[model samples]
Target chain A: LAKTTQPISMDSYEGQEVNITCSHNNIATNDYITWYQQFPSQGPRFIIQGYKTKVTNEVASLFIPADRKSSTLSLPRVSLSDTAVYYCLVLFSGTYKYIFGTGTRLKVLA
Target chain B: GAGVSQSPSNKVTEKGKDVELRCDPISGHTALYWYRQRLGQGLEFLIYFQGNSAPDKSGLPSDRFSAERTGESVSTLTIQRTQQEDSAVYLCASSQGQGLYEQYFGPGTRLTVT
Candidate 1:
């Protein structure tokens, strides 16, 4: 399993774009980076995923550096509802096992 | 279509007792996983089952923790001789397949061991 490192917490104002980055220096060639959003007392929901370069979805965008050692998750125009724990995971394509790190707790302030 | 469903949303048990948490994965999904999350902490992988292949039990914390899945349908995680540290939310997720596919999670079961 590839170990991931991310910020412990972050704060952002409403309507401002927030970006949380994760570093996985030992990422394998077959690994893929994925992010998940979790609310209090509920299970996590998938946000976006990427292998290389960048991938954008309706809810968020993922940008991976050329080395694939680090990736960033960008949430555009943050809202109070977007305040939740964001997890950056490196999925091992061989076994498909996910090793989740202590995620970044994002707080959107008004 | 119903998403993954876990029964006994909340379980309160005493130490040294045994408890079972159930999970019903989405129809047609071939991969199932169990995770434990303590308050204000990240999720900890528990066990994984894929099709009829032998489960990967490397993540199980102790010998007292075990899980079983029938075919590709329901799965049950059993905790024997639970301890106070066993208190946490038990989450279940399933995907069409393991590799590169997004997992759909169900509302976790909050287990409080007294």
Candidate 2:
């Protein structure tokens, strides 16, 4: 598993776009970048995932550079409910082992 | 299409007692995993099971911690002689075939050992 580094916390305002970036300098060729959102007292929820380039879903978008060393999760029109801890995970395809690092805590204020 | 479910949502046990944490993975999911989350901390990988193969117990913290899965259905993590340090939320997740697939998680069992 590749070690990931992210900011401890970030603050955003309502209706504004928020981007959380993660750095995985030792990322492997087979690794995929995935992001998860965790709310208080609930399990982490899958947000978006991408191997390279850009992937967009109804909820969020994932932008991965060609080098794959880093990726960013972009949330459009943030709301107060969007406040949560975001975890960036670098996992190998077809493996069950996932190492979760201290994620970036996002706070969307009104 | 129920998600992963864990039992006892909360478990309060005394030191030296054994406790069991259960996990019911999603139907047809071939991979199941166990993780621990300490208060105000990150998730810690505990174990992984795929179908009927032997589970990967390398992440088990100590000899006192063990987990078992029956077929591809349910799994139980047994903590022997629980201690105060064992207090944390035990999480369970399941994926389709593994290898970077998205995993669905349960609400998790909050274990408090006093």
Model 2 lDDT per residue over B1-114, tens place: 588999999999999999999999999999999999999887888988888889878789999999999999999999999999999999999999776679999999999999
Give model 1's docking category: high
- Candidate 2 lDDT over A1-110, as tens digits, reads 54678899999999999999999877778888889999989999999989999999999999999998899999999999999999988764335457675798999998
Q: What 10-residue stretch in candidate 2 chain B is worst by lDDT? A: B96-105
Can you tell me the DockQ of model 2? 0.78
Model 1, runs deviating above 4 Å:
A94-96
Per-model i-RMS in Å?
0.9, 1.1
Most lDDT-accurate candidate = 1
How far residue B54's Cα lies from its native spot in candidate 1, in Å, is 0.7
| Per-chain TM-score, chain A, candidate 1 | 0.94
For residues A32-106, write the lDDT of model 1, one tens digit per residue.
Answer: 888999999999999999999999999899999999999999999999999999998777655556887679999
**How many clashes in each candidate?**
0, 3
